[model samples]
Target: MGAAWEPGGAGVLALPSGRLVRGRSLRALPPGPPPQFALYLAARPVAPAQWESRWLRWLDFRLPADPGAVADALREAWQRAATERVEIACAGGLGRTGTALACLAVLDGVPPGEAVAFVRERYARRAVETAGQRRFVRRFGGLATNDPSVAE
Candidate 1:
């Protein structure tokens, strides 16, 4: 499977495994066809039915997503990114979206401590807002599998 839309520039990061995914705001979806897989993080249930979607019940502009669920979702997203157009989105597309992208970076063999910076450098300068969100990315490697490259 190929991506429905190829990411031209920022908002997309390439993993060490050669998988690519995009991070964006739910309110600022890139112009083109909808992604093959859309992972949404929000306080309330606002996930659209227009595409294959997974909603993590995360509080808007807050830290701490259900760690277990997030790990699972990130793993799934990582695996699917190999063959599908995967997107991670949140309200502002900076906080939660950035955190998730950082986690995915870890899964791609980026050190946990550097994952946030990696995403911010490639995705957005403001990616991964808040100290708690940064901490989450730092500890994400331990919460998930031992091998960051392999998704369970």
Candidate 2:
């Protein structure tokens, strides 16, 4: 029940540490086995899935509403990626999903400044869409994660 995703599979992003996490669009999910765990980024929590999932309050093209929770959820996703099929998803899967993937890159020891690029090169070229999203990824490393503001 803990088989990880195949490295380089569809939507799978291989981190510097070799951990793999998939980023997908909730609206157009890929054809494959369901992830063992998923982190859903949307304005409202998604309906429960066959596998375990955690829904974060995130709006499209915006940073997470709770930075600390984002950190924790990403850490959990990263940890599970070691031995489980973990996926990050949003409605369109480019902005919020990509931003979260970049944050996961940061957690995996890629410098925050380079994390967005890392994800774009490996995941999606147009990832982390907005300036605020990019700013959030840039500051993810230094911020306290709790009570940090990324507005405007």
Best candidate, TM-score:
2
Model 2: per-residue Cα lDDT at residue 87: 97
- Candidate 1's C-alpha runs over 4 A off are 4-10, 146-152
Query: Which regions in candidate 2 have their CA more than 4 angstroms from the true location?
Result: 144-152
lDDT of 2: 0.87
Cα displacement (Å) at residue 35, model 1? 0.6
Model 1, range 55-104, lDDT digits (tens) per residue? 99888667645777888899999988988888999988899999999999
Question: How close is each model in CA RMSD to the real structure?
Answer: 3.8, 2.2
User: In model 1, what is the error at residue 102, expressed in angstroms?
Assistant: 0.2
Candidate 2 at 44: error in angstroms?
1.2
Per-residue alpha-carbon lDDT of candidate 2 for residues 38-145, written as tens digits (9 for 90 to 100): 999999989889999999999887778878888888888989999899999999889999999999998899998999999999999998999999888888875534
The whole-model lDDT of each prediction reads 0.82, 0.87
